[model samples]
Target: MSEEKDLFQIKSCGGRKEADEIKKLLEQNDISAEVKEREKDFVVLVPNSEDIVNEALVIITSQEVYDEFYAGE
Candidate 1:
């Protein structure tokens, strides 16, 4: 593992509930993960079409972890 301080974004989850679950899995696999909240925008086209903003969490990890758990996603 290179001494890289650079952290990479691995996955973006819609909510914290899902983010935490993923975090647990990653940690169990020996990959440290962090969850950060970000703005999420979605368009709903039912009844009244409108753009909705929501809070989303993303998974962050080191380069080595990212490479090890890429999953081709």
Candidate 2:
């Protein structure tokens, strides 16, 4: 018998746009990701593995992207 694994939340965004952007970024880098809406926050989920999600988070939170995304804000 096969067992299904639960998705783990890697990050949370304030809205759909932000969540979709993050999802696209991860997908572009060959990592599978999804956005789940919980109340007003959008959560980024991946398979139940820490290494992949941790790497994704590092890329997403890097200084270059952070500056580009939030420079004017």
Maximum-TM-score candidate? 2
Provide the clashing-pair count of each candidate structure: 0, 0
Q: What is the alpha-carbon lDDT of model 1 when measured against the actual structure? A: 0.45
User: Where in model 1 is the C-alpha error above 4 Å?
Assistant: 1-5, 41-73
lDDT by residue (tens digit), candidate 2, 1-73: 0222567787889999988988888888887888889997998887677788788878788834778889878
Count backbone overlaps in model 1.
0
Q: After superposition, how far is residue 73 of candidate 1 from its true place, in Å?
A: 24
Model 2 spans with C-alpha error above 4 angstroms = 1-5, 63-65, 68-73
The per-residue C-alpha lDDT of model 2 at residue 55 equals 82
For candidate 1, lDDT tens digit of each residue in 1-73?
A: 2222334445667777866666675666545556667777211111111211111121233433676778666
- In order, what lDDT does every prediction score? 0.45, 0.79
Worst 10 residues of 1 by lDDT: 46-55
